[model samples]
Target: MTEQHGSDTGPRYAARRRRGGIVSFVVGLVATLAFFAFFPGMPHVIDWGAVLASLAVGALARAGCRAWMAKEAEKEGKRIGHF
Candidate 1:
């Protein structure tokens, strides 16, 4: 069933945005760090390219997740006659 809410941007919206930002940035940073960790022979210098790619990928993933969730919610809303 669709969730019952007074508005789309409810009290949790800010929290969710903050969390998502932190998560995405952390995931990006960790991904690059992990790659460097695996290659001991390589220079310790961080790969800015990989780090950027990680952030881009994380953003894409978040967008994909949001799209899927939105579709599901739309379906549920329609089913429940809420929209």
Candidate 2:
């Protein structure tokens, strides 16, 4: 029931890179700032919808990158990291 990977080093050496909380926080901060900076019109009260949407977009972008990397790795007979 074991899954086989193409590399001779095997899964043991196919270590996943860990993305820290700080990185995620920084990304979110930059994205939010950029959105507000370009779009303008920030309300006195926090706009939950805009905040959520920005975060969702960032998350989707990250997911898409990982998926693309995974696909590329598959083609190259290699495993992609989780991060």
Q: Give Cα-based local distance difference scores for all models.
A: 0.57, 0.56
**True-structure lDDT of candidate 1:** 0.57
What would the per-residue lDDT of candidate 1 be over residues 1-83, giving only the tens digit for each residue?
54645353434544554566567656765776677657778777667776676677777656655555456646655222211
Instruction: Summarize candidate 2's per-residue lDDT along 14-60 as a digit string, tens digits.
Output: 43212423355457656875776566565544367767766776666
Model 1 lDDT-worst window of ten: 74-83
Maximum-lDDT candidate: 1
Return the TM-score for each candidate structure: 0.49, 0.52
Per-residue lDDT value at 18 in model 1: 52
The parts of candidate 2 lying over 4 Å away from their true place are 1-29, 40-46, 79-83
Clashing pairs in model 1, backbone N/Cα/C closer than 3 A: none
- Model 1, which residues run further than 4 Å from truth? 1-45, 78-83
